[model samples]
Target: MTGFEDEIRRRLLSAQDTGRIEGLLFHSTAEPIVGRLHGDGLDVLWTARDPWVSAQYIPNAGSEILLARPDDWRLKDRVAPTKHDVLYALACEMSGKECCDVEWDWDGRAKSWRVPDGWPTYGDVVGHIEDHYGYVANSNGVYYVRESAGVVMPADWQIEGQVFVALDDGLHFKDVRRSGEPDLTEREYYDGYAFEQAMAQGYDGVIINDHCQADDYGNVPHLSFGLNAIGREKVEWLALPAVRRHLDPWYSGEAILTPDLDEWLADFEMEAVHAL
Candidate 1:
């Protein structure tokens, strides 16, 4: 019935069949919450996937709506409830809901229902802005994708024709950015944890993942070094690119694989080569 609720009703409810409506709840919370609703049991949930999402929830009346990880106690934050009927009606009129059956008048009453009964019918308002912060491999270095997207502002790095893709939080890559290309400020890129790990292992830049083997998910193959990871904080300056020490079809495909870093980096070489 309010301005924000009216806007949310126009956006999210129709996205039910689209699988994970991007902005379904949690506008002013610490993190961005997104979710979907089930019409069967009227079950619903919302969450923050950035900054390392975990299964969690908490209970309180801070807001009329509850946001949390599905089937978990780790709640993100309390969000105000929206008029689901308003959004639902808009959704049905615009895009048919194939995900679940919805009833604008589920209670059999004309929006005159009281609390507890009407509470279950309300939806939560999610914001359109999203924050993406993480480490993605660049050739010899990494691209720290630490930026947020909103209606008024454009994202700094994205997956279009741009070099940086909005990969998830826990993903890795071979050096996607090359050295001497341009932009070497820490604010643009963070000093990779992979380089730091190699230094922590007394190898210091000797064990970078320029030509390292990786899984289809962009994760380092058999890699447990826990290096080159990213946090929520933005990179203060661009970091130096990592050293190449392997051979493959990836960016630093001409480097050699080290015995210490790539004991089996050679095994995945055939697969990488076969692709080319």
Candidate 2:
């Protein structure tokens, strides 16, 4: 067996001693290489959680070996847009729209857009004059426009129903739905999607890089195991120095450990001592 396969076998045997061994899930392309795990009395499957395999023994296994990269996991979290993002979105909305050329009235204290005598002026107005642009509330509200531009009146200037909602601070805006989640990198997204699918079906952790692949892809070698809370507890031997030395060489630098796993590993040394 290859050195990589030998390392995987050693870890799997240790996991089996703790009763944490379940079937191994790998890409079909890796079938020939990892088929030896089956001879050790462990189940081995190459379907890698294909829907048809959902009812098979792999899904309900407490902790199965999944051949994958942790960095490829694509979980998403929601975040608020920055002030610049809101401004850019607003500018994009107004880039080429035309508005009426209105006049501005200076009341000594502040200057405001003055609609034509017969024009209805009840809502907010946002426009640019020559090279300057800004937002102005109704006649009774505040004006934040910059100096000098051909003022144009928007017949029905309304922004509330669109992409942005003015924040309580009045000067800032956020997404109307406030549900804008940043997109994940393509590989991360698909990886996360597949991991989630496996988790939903009851698998608890992944054994990364247990298969053979060319090393020219520029990905740092990450040969660690990643476990959810339950899997970590079940496969505690994974924390051993002997096991970790084989896995940790490129883990921190290249693998994107999930927040939960990161926290668990941070405190695991103490936890393991206490368990002893």
Candidate 3:
């Protein structure tokens, strides 16, 4: 095992109270309290006010924290974990690390890889990680999604769900009436739903009434409903004109209405041509 994996083993083995570590990563710092945004007919909503962070006095989940500062890159506010961090955790696992040097770029020359016979390639492993963790804290209904900025009222918010599928080409909507299930990734499902609805209803995108915003590259497709962890009966969908009536009181109760995306705010005029 490489030095990275050794570090993970060291941390895990040296911990006196593993429970504290879990709570620090999983549990809320304080009760995530918020009041509902009352409107005409809003029902349920989840407003993300902050990025999930570890608290000294909070309960933790079983997740581990990997802090790796990669070379030639640094964030002004925060940094994403690196390959070393991932390997470190894997090395300490019950099965130990597999294909430890499959992706080692020791020669400093790009396009060099070592593939073990009959085993899945390094690319496959990397793809899996990218697909899952890329959108760790997003605005999609499930998982950890944060809201965007400029949000104040209920109407200027969103209800993230599986409505459409955004692929390498463009956006494709799932005809819930026609198609039996959503046909895209979890990240795409929520984004596609918003895109199709906005385009169909003659709106630009989900407007932001909150104080958070970012680009669309970080979002992953929303998985199909009623499968895996997304066991909900149906996907969530909220539109611009219908937000106020559907978001209910976000700050109150157990629900909140955080804007899914701010980059979607790009100007796009929608037109209506009825098929009558």
Off by over 4 Å in 2: 1-186, 207-218, 221-224, 238-276
Q: What's each prediction's TM-score?
A: 0.16, 0.18, 0.18
Assess the local accuracy of residue 79 in candidate 2 as a C-alpha lDDT between 0 and 100. 15
lDDT of the structure predicted as candidate 1: 0.25
> 1-276 in candidate 1: lDDT tens per residue?
344433433333333334342332210122222331111121111122210111012111112211221212312332222354332332232233322322345655343322222222112211211222122334433222222231121223321110010112233323323243333232112334434443355431121112222222232221111112231121111111112222233443232212221222333455559889
The sequence of per-residue lDDT tens digits that candidate 2 reaches over residues 128-172 is 311233333434433433211222223222111100000111111
Q: Rank the candidates by TM-score, best first.
A: 3, 2, 1
State the local distance difference test value for candidate 2: 0.27
Clashes, model 1:
28
Indicate the residue-level lDDT of 249 in model 1.
Answer: 32
Candidate lDDT scores, in order, read: 0.25, 0.27, 0.25
Minimal lDDT window, size 10, model 2: 161-170
- Alpha-carbon lDDT of model 3: 0.25
